[model samples]
Target: MTELTVKKREAVGKKVKAIRRQEMVPGVLYGQKQKNEPVAVDKSAFEKAFLAAGETGVINLKIEGADKTVPVMIYALDRDPLTDKITHVDFYRVDLSQAVVAEVPLVFIGQSEAVKNEGGILVTSLKSLEMKSLPGNMPKRIEVDIAGLKTFDDVIYISDLTVPKGVEILNEPETAVASVKPPRTEKEIEAAKEGPAEEPAVEEAAVPADEEKNGGQQPAAEGTERPSEEKKADA
Candidate 1:
């Protein structure tokens, strides 16, 4: 459903800077065993279409002077670090008959009874699932229903996803998607605020001076390039 118009780019290196200043986004078309083609596309049009398609959905690329349109997906987007403006794009051409691997985002819908009445919290594990499907059959996003979580022990797993017929999920069926956790008790809250009790400090007994053992003069100073025994031997 998304589409963009792009023209074959002759600019490269520092010359591409001029292209961006002209309000065109320079890009490359690659993938599906085809040679990469340098091109420039309309800035505003490409932004809107890329936003809708993301990296998973397909887009119709209408190149300048080329009679045929190609099915492509936005593979990479280069943006200015400070301004966050679109600088460059990379489009991967898709073979319509072949299957493609893509990450499909999970959209959580509905309310859980545990969260509403029992004061339990919902925790999410996996936010997306990797899938393999034909380009035309690929879903933009998958919806995960959380209405079935009735108690703190209830959880939704990958097997519970409502996937379309042609798509194949690549994760384990037993992988948890979301779960309900029991609410914190008052005792635990108080313990958390008080933290662990500090241990009392122990005072160490002072060692007796070596002069007390030597019976007269103070012992040689510590680490003066000569040990006390060696100093006594030298004396």
Candidate 2:
């Protein structure tokens, strides 16, 4: 990656606004051996760098009045929320020989058989990774292979990545990066559309109506003669 240098800035506040009006972004740079310097860069140039190298690329920053190149990273950017126009930027000082930690985006490549052929969803847990590397050795982005995913249980972990040389991933080795999950099938959709399941009806207990109507009626004693027999003898 090459460096980009901006001219030294002289204006502030309203002057900065005027610079933006002229399609320029006001910026500042600070380094270990260098003092805080105000600079202004062509908006188009900075945009191109961001578009091509992303935020993690090692940039060669050429600042006005400095004969040598300063290794730097795009540390901060302020932009209009609605217009998405660059308002201001801050560049951080970086040493080329020393390793620096940066967050790099994760790019998943290839179509998963589980999602495309077997009707599954691709679940991605980690969208980016933290890595430490020297400016010149920084990678554009980490590429993860998902072409072999075959089932909901299929997953890719940080340990499975073949990281490029001179870069070390800062994430835990067991972290899940991507996975193939079973999609909601037609049956599941129909079940959802049907709403809650119906509960089975309970049967009511039956009461003996005859026992209730003949409240205290009693049966004849086992060894005693019936009252009808006694009545017949008397007659």
The C-alpha RMSD of each candidate to the native structure, in angstroms, is 7.6, 8.7
> What tens-digit string does per-residue lDDT give for candidate 1 at 30-55?
99788999999989888789779877
Candidate lDDT (C-alpha), each: 0.89, 0.84
Off by over 4 Å in 1: 79-85, 190-199, 205-235
Which segments of model 2 are wrong by more than 4 Å?
Answer: 190-235
As a whole number from 0 to 100, the lDDT of residue 30 in candidate 1 is 98
Candidate 2 structure quality by residue, lDDT tens digits, 1-235 = 7658699999987778888888889999986677898899999998987776667876788877878887788878898999988889888888888888888889989989898888888899998999999877778788888986877777899999987888999899999889987779789999999999999899876555754564634544679865675798998
Q: Where's the lowest-lDDT run of ten residues in candidate 2?
A: 211-220
State which candidate has the highest lDDT: 1
What is candidate 1's local distance difference test score? 0.89
Tell me how far candidate 2 lies from the true structure as C-alpha RMSD in angstroms: 8.7
